[model samples]
Target: MLETLELLKISTREQDRVEREFNMGGAQSADKGHGYHVLRVQENSPAHLAGIEPFFDYIVGINGIPLDTPESRVLQDQLLANMDKEVVLAIYSTKEQELREVPMIPNRSWTSNPGDGLIGLSIRFCTYEATNEHVWHILNVAPESPAELAGLIPYTDYIIGTPHVTLHSENDFYEFIEAYTGHPLRLYVYNSDFDACREVVITPNHAWGGEGALGCGVGYGYLHRIPKTNKYHNSQLTYQGDLKQQPQQFNDQSLPVEKSHPSMTNTDVVTVIPTTITTAPLIIETPAEPPETNRPQQSQQYPNYHQTIHFNNDKVPLDP
Candidate 1:
C-alpha cells in the first residue's frame, strides 16, 4: 500500500484514473508457447449468474489498447488489485462466432438486477459473414427471466460483438448489439470451423467495482462465453500469433557481445602455435640474387629434366 502510494505521488499520469484492462501475452505463456494468460474465472463473479464460465480466453481489445507482452499481465493484475476498477474483457468460448463483453464500468448502466449487476448479456463475437465456414450454435436454455421468456434457442448462434441478441442482417454494427435489452444469458456454441467444444460458464466478480450492477468486476477480461480464435476485426482472426518477448535491456545489449559470430570458433588452427622446428618453415627465407633465387619453385610432376633425356650408350648402337 505504501509502495503504491509513494509511486503514485511521483507518477506523471494520475494514478487513480490511469486506464487499466485485461492481460494477453507474457513470458510465462510465451516461453511455454501458451501466449499470455487471462483471468478465466474468479472465485465469485456476476458472470456466474449469467452463465459466464472461467478458463475461457480473453479475445477482444480493451480500452482501445492492444498488448503483445506478458507485462500486460502484471499491469492487468495491478488494476484489479486496486479499488474501484473498470475494464472490458472480450470473452471467447468454444461455442460461437459472435462475442460478448463483460465491462467493469460501461458508459451506460444497463442493469437493474439486485444480484446480477450486468444489464447486458456477456457473450463471444457478434458479427459474421454467411461465407464463414462454421458458426457457434447456442445450446441450452435455462428456465428463468428475459431470453428464456422470449422464444430463443440454445442451439442458435448468438450475434457477434454485443450484449444485444438480434437476428443476422446486412446493417450497421451497433444495430446488431441492440439485441439483448440487458439480461443474463447462457448460449451454446455451434462452431462449424472448429472440430469440438466443451460447455462452460463465466461469472463476473465485482470485488473491485463489485457494487452490483452499479459496479463492474475486479479482474475484467474479454468475457467470451464461447472462446474464439479471432477477434471481430477487419481481418483474418486466429489465436495463432507472434511471440511476445520481454523488453530487451538496452544498455545490457548496447554493450558489445561477450562472443563473436557463432560460425567463428576458437580453434588452434586460427591460433599461431609456437614450434621450435620452425627451420624457417622449410623455406629459403630471402632468395639469393635474382637467378640464384629463381630456381624451380615447384618440382616437375614426373621428374627432373635429366630423366626425360635418357642417353644410354646401348641405344647408340641401334641408331647407327
Candidate 2:
C-alpha cells in the first residue's frame, strides 16, 4: 500500500509579546568537534516552548540571518542587535530532513547575573580550522572551587597561560598552580563558544573542600587536548608549514620554591571512557615521589611538581 502525506502549512507569525528574556536557545559550534546542532536548551526557554530539540536541530537561518554565507558573522551580529525581541528561526532537522520555522523571543531574564545578560545561551563561530594551541581543556570544576568562583565555564573555556609562564602540557599547568597556591594568579583563557579570549584572575587554594590546589580537573588527550594555533590573518590564506613549537622549558624566577616531578608506580594501566564526560583517560598507578636526595640527579620533567590527586573510582584528576 502506498502512503500519501500532505505538508501542513502553518503561519510563521509569533503570538503575543511575552516580554520574556532574550535567548534563541543555547548552541555549540559544530566546527569544534560537536556537529552543527543545538547543544543545550534552557528550561521554559522560547526555544524550549517551541519544541526545538537540542543535539538534533541544525539552525540554517534566524529571521534574516544568513548562516552559510560569507557574511555569516555579520548576520550573527545583527541577530545580537535584536536581543530581547521576537525573531523567526529557520531550523532543519537532519534526522527527519524537514525544514520548519520556529518563532521565539530572545531574552536574558533567566540568569540572575545582569552582566551576563542578552541571552542565556552559548554560541561559537563555525570554524573547523584548529588555530588554538597551548590551551588546557577543563575537565571538571569542583563545587566551590576558585575556578567556579571566577566564572570559568567548564567544557567551554580553554586555559592558555599563567602570568609569566607558557603552559605547554598538563604538567606545566599543574606545576604552575602548586607554585601559586594561596596567591592570586592571572590566567589567560579562550572561550571557544564566543570565539574570544579574555583574562581571569583566580586564587588557587586547598581550603575549598576540593582535592587539588585549584580544585579543578584538567587533562590533555586526543579529544580534549590543546589544539593547533592559527596563523592566517591576511586575504590570501597561504598555508603555513607549522605552528611555533610549544615551550618545553619551565623557568620560574618569581617563585623561589623548587619541587621535583614524581614518577608513576608500576600498576596495570586501565583505560576507560568516563560516563560523566567522553574523556577516556588511562588510569596509571601514581606512587608517591621518592624522598628528595641531597645528591641531585637528572632534571625532572617539571621541577617542584607535587601530586595532590590520584586515580580512583571517583573523579580522577589527570596530572601526569
TM-scores vs. true structure, each candidate = 0.22, 0.33
Best by TM-score: 2
lDDT of 1 by residue, 48-101 (tens): 323333223333333323332322332233323432445444343322333334
The 10 consecutive residues of candidate 2 with the worst lDDT sum are: 14-23
Lowest-scoring 10 consecutive residues by lDDT in candidate 1?
A: 310-319
Model 1 scores a TM of 0.22
Best by lDDT: 2
Relative to the true structure, candidate 1 has a C-alpha RMSD (angstroms) of 35.6
**Model 2 Cα RMSD, Å?**
22.0
Number of colliding residue pairs in each model: 67, 11
Evaluate residue 169 in candidate 1 and report its C-alpha lDDT on the 0 to 100 scale.
Answer: 31
Residue-level lDDT tens digits of model 2 in 218-271: 654446643322211111101121111211221111101111112211111111
lDDT of 1 at 153: 43
- Candidate 2 overall Cα lDDT vs. reference? 0.39
